[model samples]
Target: MIISAIALSLLLFAAGAPAECLGEWSPHVVWHVAKIGKLTSELQLGPNGLLYALCGNKLIAVDENGNKLWESDLPDGSKSGCPVFDARGSIFIPGNALIQEVKLNGSKGWSFKVYQGSSKAAALLTTGPGNLLYMQLPTGLYAVDTAGHYKWMITQWDQVYNASTQLETDWEILASVGNDQAVFVIIGKKKEGYTLMAFGEGGKIRWRYSLGEIKQANLVVGGNGRVYATVNPKRTDDYYKGTVYAFESDGDGSPLWSYAMGCVDLTAPTPSEDGLLYFCADEKLYALNQDDGTEAWYEPLPKAISRPSVDENNMRYYLGTEDKRLLALNTEGRLDWNLTLDGKVSMRPMVGPDGYLYVVTEAGSIYKIKDEAPESDGG
Candidate 1:
């Protein structure tokens, strides 16, 4: 998918007005992180610090300095999927009924149709395990090659297709659930009503769980082989409850533990190397023990929470919040330091490979915050 690069420097220069207004706030924002394009989904920083965003029907890739490298547009009328980079620098996008492969140079390689037009973003998963696995629209799971060719498609849940049941796969397993049956029990409002299905490597049904009507986000597989998810349900006359649930990663589908909170959405779980999974729920951030789902520590913030970023040394966690604050917290969940911004933080604060914290706001502002050396008193 190699394509010749055409210079759009003039267009970029013209669109640079938003970047200029970034620091209407401070001298603290040392660098103006440019918004190369409007992102429909959250932007992910590659290991090389390159920024990748899923903007509407296009995939935009930019350098660390925010220089646009390439932008690949999707087919008109086709739903957009999240951008995921495979090992070969190829991009995998599952949209509508098709899984498309994109080259690093912003060219289309090939595509495989996994579903008709029922594919949902929640059904797709990407991870490293010597193989690439993906979920099909409607109800199926498949693994394909770097070239967009299908390896296998699992139809074990074909019988549940008429029931609106959903399926997902991650790390190296698959899970499915029908709309009517009980798979896993969800105790409260936040804990209730979502169907989960788990499968093993060979397309075997490993486990099934039911959540009673709660919206689950950041479903991830932990190191100990447990599936962790954040649950949030719509507000009702009853008190709203938000929770994180951990299930046995192996196909047994048993519950490990659940933590409750107020109305909040948890960004995907950020599991630390020390066996702790970090999550942001409601206005609080928590680090929990993955083994039995016990709270190791938690930090209540001045505002609603955003996704967290771990420091280079893993000793600190960085998060932005609705109250327009950027904070760094120590491992103990104590505030290490914090800075205030003029605008709200709806985007996840990105910690670039260069050690700079990149933040963007709904007001179209981008700021790069870095640690300044301690000031010394004049002798």
Candidate 2:
């Protein structure tokens, strides 16, 4: 009989709970070693089922057994951010002034020159419809086709009021693509304000919304064409006061709902398949209803949590913490297990295709944890 995720979690928790209440559930480590160089990006599972790791300036692909498949050196010997894969399975690596496309077999494809005469690197990379690639820079957004040819570019800037000169402020652009292939970006002007914009076909502006004077903000596009942004209060004394705002993706930025969260240093909100949003801040994990931003549940953590990875089939999520521990939580926001690692975990845990958990530590060690119980040896 198939047990529900909550029931399975309870059974596992009872079987694995320690005397100290640390919830230690030690899964068999398939492999643990510092194979890659100082890891600088979160591990990503590609469509080909190989684990892609960006370590320093090298991009390495490894199989489930930790066997090296191939490796490629990035341009300028460094990466500005994590790489993204297109619908055709080509990996796009962002660098200063260029975005390089690499094939799965470790060969180089065309390099698209996104910026001219500026040494500034791309802040984010995402894929859009029609096999198009989107790159966000401090100044503008560029859309390129699969062959690395420019489709369109958006360079318009909005004025932000600041004490200093009303100069064009460099924006921290956070971008994500929706199910409809529309590109959504949240522009956080330095010490000024925030703006949300949606780009449709031919890079046309579909909608724009202004969030006045937010100290920090992050954006995510939901499956149903809704944009969600978590904004922190701008005042230094009100650091813990934050809000999550939901807006229709296509309209004139009309609000759907807003939820107040006593969150400090909030991570990006992650949307699950069941219309729930998950985020962590101030050593607590919260689940909110995506339709109305109502509280679903929350659980406190021993340390600050990183971004979580959800397994939809099993209805569970995994996250790492600053205190060198990996945690697995059920959909009900209950702790299922926790395992202490060698070093602090700064990135989200990656779930491989074969149901193995892959994690990397700040000290550069990579580990693969089994997701299922091991078979018993007959005594």
The residue-by-residue lDDT of candidate 1 on 28-142, one tens digit each, is 4544544444555566766455666676577766665545667778653134335667667777765655667767667888876654333343334443223554544434556
* CA lDDT, every model vs. true structure: 0.57, 0.70
Give the winner by lDDT.
Answer: 2
**Per-residue CA lDDT of candidate 2, range 66-150, in tens?**
6565678877644556788866878888776578888876788888874433435455677765667777777667888888888
Clashing pairs in 2: none
Which candidate achieves the best TM-score against the true structure?
2
Q: What is the lDDT of candidate 1?
A: 0.57
- Work out the TM-score per prediction: 0.74, 0.83
Off by over 4 Å in 2: 1-26, 116-119, 158-169, 174-181, 233-240, 373-379
